[model samples]
Target: MATHAVRVSGLVRSFGDRNVLDGLDLAIAPGEFVAILGRSGSGKSTLLKAVAGLDYDVTGDGDIAVAGEIAVAFQDSRLLPWLRVVDNVELGVRPGRGTAALAEVGLEGRERAWPSELSGGEQQRVALARCLVREPRVLLADEPFGALDALTRIRMHDLLRELCAKHQPAVLLVTHDVDEAIELADRVVVLHEGRIGLDVPAHDADRTHLLRALGIGVAA
Candidate 1:
């Protein structure tokens, strides 16, 4: 069995007496790609924030430790408009790692281009390259492709899968699109009402079964 890259037990989070995560427990193995699915206000993003140590009010019994640093990609590209693409990617690199990271994301020739000059997909690629430059042990993405159009989103999904495979980071993606999750993740975890409602492998049959379990009708 693969060793766990992240473990959570009894995790609880609240905002003004309204609990968002209640006793959530999960274990993510190294090199695994996991997708988190949930409706609005289901605490999916909150969970990622807590794991990344960006949320200070979370209380949990388990610890999340990565073999290396953790990197996050948010819904927005979060690129610096004043800087060129390569420069933005370089921000996350230690000293001499930016070029390699950009190359890894297939942005070798576009390094000098400004964010405004690139397509939305390309900008998102830049954001991903920034995260990749960190050589993270874990990649936490919160709706990273949410704002893109359908075609662009699909392309980004493929890029993300290829990059994660190449880099071998344990990935946790928060998305509302079930089909996207099924296609990209090794495992799909559904968060409902502040708890884990379903956890299953992402095999075709298993994804169908999970959808059924969640009372979401699968297409005929």
Candidate 2:
């Protein structure tokens, strides 16, 4: 068995003259949660897309490996408007699995609700249910909770931690929020010019150091 749920070697991606990812390498242990922090256009999403095998036109000079199924959740819930909530979760999974997945995300009785009827947080929950229903080995969450309000984001964070513990899938969360990364990730890496500039365990993450690395000044 592979020791890592996801691996990238010598990864490089470019658009026109700019290289978004230049020889970046990363490894995610099975069941470990990692968060990535970077400035806008720092290639955080690009790296996640590469791991999910969703990169095409810009992918160059890299190898990505995964031990099992990979699922992705974006800032947008991306649920099908026409499908009932349960049906959305069941899209790529077995018919009966949606109910269990929805239950896991605290939306058990909402299986019949329409996407239009769900609140923003509820829609994101449905999105998570859809991803978790696949029993994925790796879950790539690209600012999954970025759209939620502060209180809802906090709730979603706790829910995500619980779900990840239960499912034991390696997770890669890309976000701009430093506090969010500290709260959720076992490890956090700051991406600079497509390469990892600072990698540290979240529990001991230095706020000033992280902020400085992102080219932001700490108000000392």
Of the candidates shown, which would achieve the greatest TM-score relative to the real structure? 2
lDDT of 1 by residue, 1-220 (tens): 4378888777888887778988889888889999999878888998999888898865444455555578999999999999988889988456667778888777888888999999888889999999987778889999999999999998898899889888889999999888888999999998887899988888842756667655678898
Q: Model 2: residues >4 Å from true position, as ranges? A: none
**Candidate 2 — what's its lDDT?**
0.93
- Backbone clashes for every candidate come to 0, 0
Candidate 2 lDDT tens digits, 1-220? 6799998999999998899999999999999999999999999999998888888787488788899999999999999999999999999776988998999999989999999999999999999999999989999999999889999999999999999999989999999999999899999999999899999999999888889999998887
What lDDT does each candidate get?
0.85, 0.93
Q: For candidate 2, what is the TM-score?
A: 0.98
Error of 1 at 33 (Å): 0.5
Which stretches of model 1 miss by more than 4 angstroms?
57-63, 204-208, 212-220
